[model samples]
Target chain A: MIELHRVSKVYSVGPVKVPALREVSFRIGKGEFVVLTGASGAGKTTLLRLLYRDDLPSEGDVEVLGYGLVQMRRSQVAAFRRSIGVVFQDAKLLPVRTVYENVAFVLRVLGTPRRDITARAFDALRAVGLSARAQAYPAQLSQGEAQRAALARAIVRRPPLLLADEPTGNLDEAMAGEIVDVLKDIGAGGTTIVLATHQARLAVALRRRTLTLEGGRIVKDEG
Target chain B: MLGFLVGEALRDLRRAGRVAVSAVVLITLSLAALGGFWLVSSNLGHAVAKWRDRVRIVVYLKREPPGGDVAALLERVRVMPGVAGVVFIGKADALRALKQVLGKDAGVVDQLPVNPLPASLEVTPSAAAVTPEGARELLARLAVLPEADDVAGSADWVERFSHWQRLLTTIGLGVGFVLAAASILTVTTATTLILHARRHETEIMRLVGASEWTIRLPVLLQGMMQGLAGAILALGALVVTHSVVAPRLEPLVSLTLGLSQLVFFTPVGVVALLGAGTLLGGLGGWLARAAREP
Candidate 1:
């Protein structure tokens, strides 16, 4: 479902050209739960951004869900995005909305029927163990609970691919374990998951295929 | 989709709070000022038209002409190119007309030992000759008449009134433009504040594949609502102003210009004012959205 051939990313800051990814290539089949581990500035975020087609590669090709990122138009990018979900490090839930509304927002964007949205949003919240806090606003939630709410929002649309970039980066070890278990359940339900993080021990304990990035290149791939 | 868009718009408007209220107030003020000037200009235009139609050239004879000569001169003036009608006013008849115009002040006029008014030919000009250029031409012709000592008319005053009407219109437009600009800026600022406050939500929306319009339509609608509210308030204010002032001012207007009643905006004017307000708000919202980082 995903492929990148020697992809490289260079960001220009003033007169300097900084490389984020260099000649990196990877592939993940459908319904796989894969973890990406790297230190800070190891290009984990850039790799995830490329997979979501948020940023284009300076050199080489990227293919996600059979659409060539380089050739995609703006309309196609939007259409492509509907089939994939992203979870940011900060969770990025709307502070003004309750947890249920935050999850239902994705369904609303997809124009699901209100009746269906109610059922599906509740189910997604249940999966994340956030159904009890459905009416709680993001500001009122604990960091772990907010991340879980963000997870519910991400999966509300039942996207085929889920890309999480350090979703538990700010949580305690216990909270991180709980969040990862929820992600494991989501993966068991057949959604492909690509989780990027710098937590080496958590990545190993998850017991999934792990890819390590160091200086924008894949240093190890353990299937 | 429509319900969601509209619901989000209303929510945004509610969230806008003071900024939105201030925007409505600004719009109301802008449109009120605009409508006020428009009303003045309309009334002035009516006065100008009435005065133009009454424009005439008065030829003052050197002395009372013989009856036959008076008849001959009247016939000649009536046949002139731009002359609509001519009435010969004799000295006694002119004095009687003056007494009628002066009302209770006629006793002061009657105290004069001698009839000092001039015997003149009151020359009414045709519609085509009521213009500044046409009136000037006709006046020049009347001035050279053999029986004329001096010629005078209200044409100059009519022309001045017309100039004042034009000037009022220009000033109204200038003020309207400035106020509209201010309103647009205020609305833009309000929308930008909302944008900044909701930046996180917007980013999440994009991540979840929300359409561009799903994100933007609410902001546009919020702006439109502000504009519409402002226009409605301004219209309300205008109605109250007219109602309170029109009755008291009606007699003054009638006494001076002989108009039966004061006028307000026609239905078309009301629609245009509301449309202008809405457009101003829409423009501000659009600018706010355009300035957002995609």
Candidate 2:
């Protein structure tokens, strides 16, 4: 489902070329739930961004779901994105929109039929256990609820691949474990998942294949 | 999809709040100024058309045409280019017309030792010669006539009025353009603010596979809505002003311009104003989006 061959990304600040990812390489088959664990500046976010085509690697090839990330045209990027789901460290829900509206927003943008949108949105929200809090605004929801709402929004279209970046970063231990359980359920349903986090214990606890990165290079890959 | 876009646009406009309101106000003021000038120009155009038909040029002769030659001279003048018709007036007839014009003061004209009035030929120009340039050309031709002493045409005053109308239109266009530029800039600023305010929402939308059009169209629509609102308000202001002021100004207009009644913009003109406002607003929105995205 995904392959990155010697992908290297560099950021330029004046005269300095700061490498975010240096010769990083990985491959994962369909339906794999992979945990990308690393410290604060270990290039986890950069790798996910490259996979989602949000940023281009300065060198090497990155492919996801058969699309060559570097060669993809701008017009094709939106269509490619629709085939996958992405969640950020922050649950970027529109503050003014209710949780339900936030979830339904993705379907609306995809031009889903009016009749199907309610059913699909509700199903997604129900999957994330946010059905009861659907009408609550993001500001009113607890941090965990807001994150679940964001997850519902990401998965509403039933995209085959899901990428979550530090989704449980702000949650307590119990809340983080609950979110992982939800991610596990989603993965069990045959959606490929990549969850990035700085907490190594969470990756070990889940018993999933984990990739550890340090100084912009993947240092370990083991179950 | 269209409904969703419009909804998003409305939401953005609401979010823009005071900035949106200010943009609309600017548009309204600009359109109103332009529409006001158009209204005045329309009335002036009508007056010019009406007065053109009554334009007359009088060619005073050095002396009365000798005996039977008066009819021959009248026929000659009538056949000249742009001459619609000609009437020969003898000195006696000129004096009689003067006495009638002087009304109760006719006794003063009777007290003169002799009629000081010159016999003249009244020349009515055809439609082709009604224009200031056309009248001047015809006047030059008549002035060179063998028996012509002095030639005077009513075209001069009409020409002056036409000049004023043209000047007003030019000034109106200049002012309207400046105001339109200002409105567009205001709209751009307003849309930019909304874009910044919704940055997080936009990022989420993009990540969720929203198309570029889906992400950007709301900003454009917000600007367009502002323009549309401004256009409607401008039209309303113009109608109210015309209704309240036209009647009071009609008498003066009639006395000066000889127009029987004042007229407002035609249906086409109203549509044009609305279209212009919407286009201006849309342009502003498009610019803002382009600047941000590009």
Give the CAPRI rating of model 2: medium
Q: Summarize candidate 1's per-residue lDDT along B1-294 as a digit string, tens digits.
A: 778877877888877889988988999999999999999899988888888777768899999898889889999999998899999999999999999999989999968999999899999998888877888899999998989999988477777878989999999989988998999999999999888776776777677777888888888988888888899999999999999999999999988876678899999999998998889888888889898856
For each candidate, give its TM-score against the true structure. Answer: 0.85, 0.90
For model 1 chain A, give the 10-residue run with minimal summed lDDT.
Answer: A70-79
lDDT value, candidate 2, whole model: 0.92
lDDT of 1: 0.90
Candidate 2, A196-215: lDDT as tens digits: 99998898999999999999
Clashes of each: 0, 0
Interface RMSD of 1: 1.2
Q: Rate the local accuracy (lDDT) of all candidates.
A: 0.90, 0.92
- Candidate 1 chain B TM? 0.80
Query: B-chain TM-score, every candidate?
Result: 0.80, 0.84
Q: Which ten residues in a row have the lowest lDDT in candidate 2 chain B?
A: B153-162
DockQ for the candidates, in order = 0.56, 0.69
